[model samples]
Target: MKKIALAFLCFLATDSMAQVSQDSTISAKEEIEIIEKDTLFIDMAKYKLTIPNNWKIKAGCTEEQCTANSPQDTLGGFDTYIESINITVNKLSSSSYTAEKYANFSIGYLPKVVKGFKVLEKKRLNSYSYRVTYTGSKNNIEQTWRQYYHVRSSKVYIITFSAQARKYDHYQPIMEPYLASFKFK
Candidate 1:
């Protein structure tokens, strides 16, 4: 019994010592706060797009936003060869914005954008309320893909992912995971 008690006391002392050592390693210079991943992240709410992780969030047209700094304009003979994510939120009382509306906007912009592009696939997440996904092509040769997600309650949340027709296949896998991670509470 005496030996057992001695061993137990030693184990406790060792455990306490280990904890003290760990506590000491956390210096005052280091931030003590835990940095949690942003679950309610929206790069741009109005555009219904998400800001890619690599892309820094810059001041957008609205108070809540960010945009790619590449300054890409499809009108400049630039083929629509890009991938993008978008998100937006609206009030429950507001008019419903469907995935088709966004697709129409893309169609409208495509004329101003790359000259020959048509939508390919457009999907809406029924579980996510107003979420939508769209894939299209440029001149039937270059394919593009887009995804949109929205929430309807007090406010609507929209999230979109887009890529050029040619690059859609390549970027699909990369963006799909991030798209899957989208959730708002």
Candidate 2:
């Protein structure tokens, strides 16, 4: 009787553990599904990206234009977007122009034109890719911005992500994947 009782208790514990593990696995899968649901693939003339579905292309801008704006609400007595992503293609002035050089030149120029410009971080993604993060004010509201650059075949692709400064961390997960999904075609 004692041996049978011990075996029954062990079985219950094992079953309970299995249930918890299964629940955890289900939760993880659901999370992945949620993230996948938010993604939208955008194909442009020379590039493509997977952006969040909540973002909409600005009026009069086509998918090929590579400009999208996040949902907006009136904040600080002004109409403004919560975030925006703009992808622009620029013809390289010279064949020798490199992504790193373009990135550095772009960041170096920001302070000259952007109000209250402050560099937060600048890092190279690879030999030919770079990213920069900075903060500035527009219409008296502080904003944070990130720019990722990829140079390919005499064209420079610039992907700029901008959000309210306070919301930058909250939106990083969404933004990072969108930037990562950028591909040159």
How would you encode candidate 1's per-residue C-alpha lDDT over 1-185 as one tens digit per residue? 53453344334333433221112133323312211221113322222222222332323334123223212334337754444554444455435655445445545666555445445555655744433334444454444545454544445444556555555564555455456655553
97-124 per-residue lDDT for model 2 (tens digits): 9888998798788887679999898888
Show the colliding residue pairs in model 2.
none
Provide the global lDDT of candidate 2 against the true structure: 0.69
User: Who wins the lDDT comparison?
Assistant: 2
**Ten residues in a row with the worst lDDT in model 2?**
17-26
Candidate 1 has what TM-score? 0.45
> lDDT for each of the candidates?
0.42, 0.69
Model 2 ranges off by over 4 Å: 1-32, 62-64, 73-80
**Collision count of model 2:** 0
User: Quick one: how many clashes does candidate 1 have?
Assistant: 20
